[model samples]
Target: MTELSLRTRESFDAVMRKYADMVYRLAYARTGSTFDADDILQEVFLRYIRADKTYNDEEHRKAWLIRITVNCTRSFAASAYNRHRDLSEPDENAGAEDPALKAAETKSDVMKALLELPEKYRTAIYLFYYEDMSVAQIAKSLGTTETNVKTRLSRGRDMLKEKLKGVEFDV
Candidate 1:
């Protein structure tokens, strides 16, 4: 990259403020480690600062950011560093309260059930219900077909339901 000055620091700070938590959560979900997720967040924003790219709209920018996050997390997961390490307890309290999911359940219960899911299934569920992405959009972000995204969501939901059975929480 040519000197790392694609945008003003102020603009980059704005982007970080808006997307940092989302990026962090995505990284955490993939790695199951807070340290690695924080590292990925820094690397993603650093790359964004150095890349010379244009976006037509906010949605496009968000899509690009999500793509970068997914790629970064995948690379992190494949690294020798990750391969040699046992995944740690998830370090963040992830998931938002869903009025549609009211129950006699705590956030930790939902988070624990979510974490018990396989990586792909957890990611699919996060993007669908939490990120509010459509199946087509998720397919595009995940570089899979819509059918595959739908299937992942279905399987993910089933897994979550099984994991959270009798917890009074709805998926």
Candidate 2:
């Protein structure tokens, strides 16, 4: 177990180095602001450090971290909404300067459309497309059946297509 501790620390460091950007992106997609996403990332790692010992396996640990991140983002959104008495708006600079910024801008329009969706559909779409989770994984993460995830994904995509019909894309 002593060796495992060292290996876990090494593995954790490697994972953070490799996937930190991915985590931030996921958090940003969920929270819509770099500042809030930064906070969420920190909170996710803190939770990971204090996580249960049973998640000794790497895959289990990664899933646990993602779950914590998603939960924290949802909680933050709820609290922000309660405090402001309005839906938190997406940051205007949500997509700024990546090579794919133009494509992302189109997607951001879709995301804005997604913001109009009920939380269930919004989360399903974000997890399925942006986070690339499978329907089964999304269902497990959301505590729903895979069939429900599929239904939500379908509905969300249709809504996005409808909302984006007239949006002009630069590219």
Clashes of each: 0, 0
1-171 per-residue lDDT for model 2 (tens digits): 132332344556565655577677767666555667778888777666665345556555556666777788878877855456455554445466433334445656665676666667877887777667788888877678999998998887777778889744221
Per-candidate TM equals: 0.78, 0.69
Q: Top model by lDDT, which number?
A: 1
Task: Show pairs that collide, candidate 1.
Answer: none
lDDT per residue (tens digit) for residues 1-171 in model 1: 122233435377777778898888887776555667778999999888877476666666777788898999988878876666555643233354432223313446777677668888888888888888888888888899999988888888888778778644244
Alpha-carbon runs more than 4 Å astray in model 2 = 1-7, 52-58, 80-84, 88-117, 166-171
In angstroms, give how far residue 141 of model 1 lies from its true place: 0.7
lDDT of 2: 0.67
Error of 1 at 103 (Å): 18
